[model samples]
Target chain A: MADKKTKNVFKKGAISSDFIGTSIAKHQSKTTIGAHNIFLGQVRADVIDNKTVAAIEYTAYEDMANEKFHAIREATFKKFDLTCMHIYHSLGTVKAGEICLFVFASSPKRKIVFKAIEYIVEAIKADVPVFGKEIFEDETHQWKVNK
Target chain B: MTINVKYFGLIAEITTCEKERILFTKKNVSEFLELLYLKYPSLKNKDFQVAQNQELVSQDALISGHELALLPPFAGG
Candidate 1:
């Protein structure tokens, strides 16, 4: 359950819906997985001080971010009866309405996957060293903070 | 000891560089930060955490690693 190897959890840009669909299709052969839960984080067009955010440019301490992601994966496996889990986050610019984060968890049962998905997503939000720069419509920018 | 210090997010904006090598003979995190504060005083006003060798450590932790990072609030989803 404790996976020792670290995997890269970052992508260059927005995670395409097609990619997510392909991922799901690939798992069809794994008939042991009875349920899959997914969490997609879309960039929001937030209006702040009359400025609308157009996109988010994400960056990270890659070495630390990957290690933290690996730790979260290991913890999730140990805590749940999940068959597998995958997490991908955008590293560069992700436009508003585009997917920036994708989390998928599969399990033999439905309940485990539901819980596992939430746990992984929350851990990523709180522990990962990824930063976001909100680019406003006027080309101005501000750092994003997790709430 | 020369430490490879990394800055991320707004921390990099404040330092004006993403990475730098600091010649530090410090004993702990606080001492190393004090040295940094003298060089970049505005960093003192920023909210960030310290990571030594890719692991978060307290301010009193010993400077045992060759790499250090200044990380701001995480916005990861």
Candidate 2:
């Protein structure tokens, strides 16, 4: 039951770097996995119709986003034998080409960790309620959800 | 009663404010939307979602005096 409780971590808005690092350290155990896989998502500067995107502003319906994130974390744990997992997303304003999300998963072996990492990242992109705003160098902006 | 309504993304652009309190009938979600649309006709066709008290709900869902938010389709990484 304690193991089940440790599998999911969700918070409103962006997660700090210290939180991500500490979460991994807390889950480290002798009986747990020897290998951990992490995936970090960052925004990129892309030109759309001759306008270059300078940065991205991230936002969320905080109440709903938090609920959805927690639900997804629980679902991921049930689907896999993960020793632990962590997910963090940005909120408010994040510049283009900046880090937006960090996902880390560890298990008992290489195979499970690899599979779990893929699953968690995919689930976050597909299911989470976080949204992004694409800011152009020209000072215009547009909102986008990860696809 | 007057309830506070929050707008995000493109919806904020139309409303010109992030939060506002409007006089509304104590009606279901759909009825409130009808009133909102009448006030901001430009929002009638834009693809957006709604949430009450931080929970996502369908347009026709029932709501009463809860915090409401209008979210345009999300574009986050």
What digit string (tens of lDDT, one per residue) describes model 2 on residues A1-147?
Answer: 224332323344445667768877776554657778888777788888899888777766666766766776788788877777766777766665566788877777888878878877777776555667788999987777555
**What is the per-candidate TM-score for chain B?**
0.98, 0.90
| Full-model lDDT, candidate 1 | 0.94
**B5: Cα error in model 1, Å:** 0.2
**On a 0 to 1 TM-score scale, where does candidate 2 land against the true structure?**
0.82
User: How would you encode candidate 1's per-residue C-alpha lDDT over B1-77 as one tens digit per residue?
Assistant: 89999999999999999999999887999999999999999999899999999999999999999999999999997
lDDT of 2 by residue, B1-77 (tens): 78789998778889888898888875677788889999899999888778888777886787765589888876645
Q: lDDT (0-100) at residue B20 of candidate 2?
A: 89
Q: Which candidate wins on TM-score?
A: 1
DockQ of each: 0.94, 0.48
Per-model TM values vs. the true structure? 0.98, 0.82
Question: Which stretches of candidate 1 lie above 4 Å from their native place?
Answer: A1-4
